[model samples]
Target: MNILQAKNEIKNTVQAYLSKNSFGEYEIESKNQRPLLLIGPPGIGKTQIMEQISKECQIGLVSYTITHHTRQSAVGLPFIQEKEFQGKTYSITEYTMSEIIASVYSKMEETGLKEGILFIDEINCVSETLAPTMLQFLQNKTFGNQKVPAGWIIVAAGNPSEYNKSVRDFDVVTMDRIRYIHVETDYYVWKEYAISKHIHPMILSYLELKPNNFYTVSTSVDGMEFVTARGWEDLSYLLYSYEKMLLEISQDTIYEYLHHEDIAEDVFAYYLVYKKYQDDYGIDDILNGNVSSSIYARLFNADFDERVSVVNLVMDGLLRQVNIYSFEKHCTDLWFGFLKNYRNHMDVSYVDHVKEFIALYHDKLQAELLSDAQKHEYEFVLEQIQKVNVDASLDSKSRFDCSTKPFFKQKENMESIESDLKLQIENAFEFMESAFKNGQEMTIFVTNLIMSAEMALYLSSHTIGIYEKYKQVLLIGSQKARLLDELAH
Candidate 1:
């Protein structure tokens, strides 16, 4: 399975475990539950998926790299204690709480969450001294003499023996005690994730053209030449920051992240081309519905690569507009809801408290209350409350306009922004239709848009008032269907 499939599987497994057992409840005799062992290549998002699962389940997570621990730290240190056995007192050995176990308890206390996942990475790459303890920990769910807390699930991950020299294969007896999942690299599965994460389009376009270069690990004269999903994501952050600073991306910079020489050179060369496209294509003008005849002529005469770049450029611009509008609507709704609740339930008591404070400090604070800044601050809150209540029954766009009035400073300016976004979406739809009519292949472009729209839909469903505002414009039926077909494949 690919990483995405593995992520879903892990999520389902965690949900099932939580369903069968309530928080802080565990039975030692139960045979239905077992720990998960994720075996995969290095840097293939094994740890990243666990974090995502923790967030999705709304549970706490405690992660540790077992290779970094010793037997003493992992299973705790031994201490001497007095015990009475057979009417004679004797000094016996007992172990303190394992650092790993202590961290789980601390996280639960800090988060106030009884149930969570305790993830140990590099489980198969532990030192020889710690190997026996790891086996006992997995099979018995205990460190030294202390068992894992009841509500926490144990998940361990490791790179396969083929990928890491230190990896040790589990014996049959140990294998029988846990569930295992093997994950492989799939470019298409990760492309959807990259689009949703807003990975640099330069990397996305380069990968689309040379999919084979997306992931590779081979021994070379330079020791090892490799590229992984983790590399791309980390590089994307640096590239984004560099672009913001208007700095020139040097060959050294590219090679620092993309370790493979050939792949790094290819990406750097294509990045130059991508920069050229950005310079030639006026995305802002297109968004404003100001595309000139020269631009259209260029599009008609351009090759497949240029056409793809143009489509990506347009799609990027459109998505940004939609994101901005959706974010504004979400914020406006939240503010309106808060103001309404305060007015209905808390305003009277709040005012009474203020009055009491003034009465108690009339002489000392009367002049302070009369100050211009304090008067303005008090009036501002009341004015905002009034404005929100007045616009509560209006449409989303109208409510947004009212909400942003203080910030935008002009109704016409806000309306103009709203109008511009609508125009951009319409223009994007028309561009996509024209591309299809002209027999231009836009599979990658369409797929990327669909993935972004799906992410937006997910967010909208999770949030209030965003779906009604963005669904029609962002996730139109035709685009949604195309994306579904892609996923089905």
Candidate 2:
């Protein structure tokens, strides 16, 4: 089972104890407390579970790392000779009183709990020198000459001895007194919690990376170590910029962080399988070539259904290994190229489907062009005005009054004409695919221009002959050319 499932089991087990109707036959005023043991992997949140239970039960949690305490810390130093008490002849036992009570009072205020919880993290990591003292405390719930506060409950967590070579074996005497709950990693449950919090999308995306497949390098002189869940979290933030790294990071950055080169090697190894396929045949050939004799000859030799299944499995696995964001960008660029080609030679039905997307893009392009044309016309008029103003030879006042107003008006009219002609030309281009509906190759643009009256006058009579092959879609001739000329002016 995963860490979350293990945690829930522990919580449920403790809740049963808490829910016990009778507290050792003592009246409601008195009770007996049962302590607990949490056993789990290093990063699997054993201590976190105890804290959660304390909060849910409305009890304060005080934690100490047993591994950090030594014989010196547990046993007080003797006082200086002269400073030692004379009348009472007290020993360090009197001073140990102050230290023990200090640990108790804080629990009283936080939980308002008649009894609170004492959380011992990494209990199994305690040094051999301090192990006897820990056993004494566990056996009697007392340290030094004094007992732990009456209302306090003891809960200890430790990584399994199997996890590390340094982990010392726990004596059966210490093990028998408390319950043991084993915890494992559970990314699925963590994902649910992360989603509920509405975690940042970018962070959530990294978290969603396949848990078993990712890692970073270690800085050991001998070699690299594997990354843990905690290491992944730290490296994710560092990799957010998505820039490729050059040299190595400093020791200070990764000294305490875990890294696993094996996982990284595995990921690279997975990638090479795809590369091997490419070396044998081109990517396009693999994608579009005959399957039976090509790269997938073995799978192609199978039944059609089995071959399809194998193809799907390989594709899905390869796709999952890819950096999705980059793959999506590549697909979008390819689709856009297809769109441009489709605009040139597709049939009417396909063109109509393509038009929906183009309609929005077309409006944007037209608006941009119209804005540029107006700016250019305005600049030209300004240049003309400047020329008239600077020329000492010209009549400046007449030049100012010389009907540039008509030119400006013509430009405005041309702007409107340009918009109209652009719409017609775009429409003609858009409609050319109509001839393809019946699978014909006639050039509709030639016919439309030939029939256009405005276009006919601009064209020599010889030019009309060029339209003989496309008489099916004739336009009204000069009408088209006049419209174009107006827009051009």
Candidate 3:
């Protein structure tokens, strides 16, 4: 299975476990709950999937690397205590709570979520002294004498023995005590994630051309040569920051992430082409339906790889519009909800809810907890709320009209909006028709655009006239038509 499939499987397993056990209830004498073990190569998103599961399930997560712990930390330190056995008093040994278990309890207190996942990474790479304790933790679901709290699920992950020399293969008895899953790298699966995450377009276009380079691990005289999904994602963030600062991204900068020299050079060369496409075809003008004939001429003259890079650039622009419209629609809905509640439910009080919301915002603000970007969002939401309240002073219908004016304006201009999106789609199709001729490139382009969670959510929620028109544009050609038909089922 790929990372996406493994993510779904783990989510389902967690959901089922929570449901069957009533959110962590189990009898000590009954069958012991088995931990989930994710066995896979390093940097294939095993740890990331666990975090996603935690967020989707709305539960707390406490992650630790067992290799970072010693035997004392893994099972806690021992202390002497007095105990009475019958008539005589005797000294007894007791252990403090394991740091790992203490972290779980601390997260529960902070998040107020009793049920969650305790994720231990590099479980199979523990030190020799801690190996027995690791087995005991997995099989018994306990650290020394302190059992894991009810309602918490245990999940452990480790790189395969081939990936790490320190990795120890689990015995059959230990393996039988867990639900083990194996994950492999798949470009197509990661591509969808990359598109949704808005990974660097340069990386995306490069990977599109050389999908085989997505995951590689080789040993050479210099030591180990490797590239992993984690490496690309981390590098994407750095590139984005560098671009924001208007800094030149040299080949050395790329090689820092992609260790393979040849692969790095290939990607750096493609990145130059990708950046040239961005400049030559202004995405802003393209989005505004002001595309020049010279752009189309250049597209026709370009080779296959260049054409693919152009397609990636255009698709990136279109997705940006989708993201903007999605956010606007969300704000519009929030505005409408506020207006409706304020007018129709005049007798009822929203004081408590409003106070709670304001209190939460102020708490975050005063604690200096919000990042600069998050602080900007917090201010924007407050501004919107204040604007709506100010509009409430007008007459009932006038207030309603004022509050929903932007939404109504957008609704009234659906035709023009649809026309712009349709033009962008047609422009892409025209290039695809002339450049590729066989429609394979067009198929991949449209598939990348439409097969995203964001796109699916937009289509499902915004079934208005403009979205339907945009959908038609996406489903125009035979290749896209077939793809849409398959997705519909």
Cα deviation of 412 in candidate 1 (Å)?
10
Candidate 2 matches the true fold with a TM-score of 0.43
Q: In model 1, what is the error at residue 12, expressed in angstroms? A: 1.1
State the lDDT of candidate 2 residue by residue for 1-489, as single tens digits.
666676676566545544534555323211244456677667555665666666556555678877777665554433434334656654333324424335666556543455456787877777778777677666666665556775566777787775655676667886676666666666544443433222222233333334443233335676646555555455444533332454333333433444444444443343344334434434232333223343344433544323222232322222222223222323333344434553454443333433554454344333332233334433443333333222224453443334234435544554454344333333333222331221111222243233322333323322333233233233324455334422321
lDDT top scorer: 3
**Candidate 3 residue runs with Cα over 4 Å from true position:** 20-31, 348-353, 359-379, 387-438, 459-489
lDDT of 3 by residue, 12-129 (tens): 8778667644455543322366798998888888888887788778777789988999989879999999999999999999999999889888887766777888999999999899
Shift of residue 372 alpha carbon in model 2, Å: 54
CA deviation > 4 Å runs, candidate 2: 13-34, 75-95, 98-101, 196-209, 214-224, 234-258, 262-489
Q: Which stretches of candidate 1 lie over 4 Å from their true place?
A: 20-31, 347-419, 435-440, 453-489
- The local lDDT score (0 to 100) that residue 396 gets in candidate 1 is 47
Q: After superposition, how far is residue 294 of candidate 1 from its true place, in Å?
A: 1.9
lDDT of 1 by residue, 385-421 (tens): 4443334466545554454445344334445555666
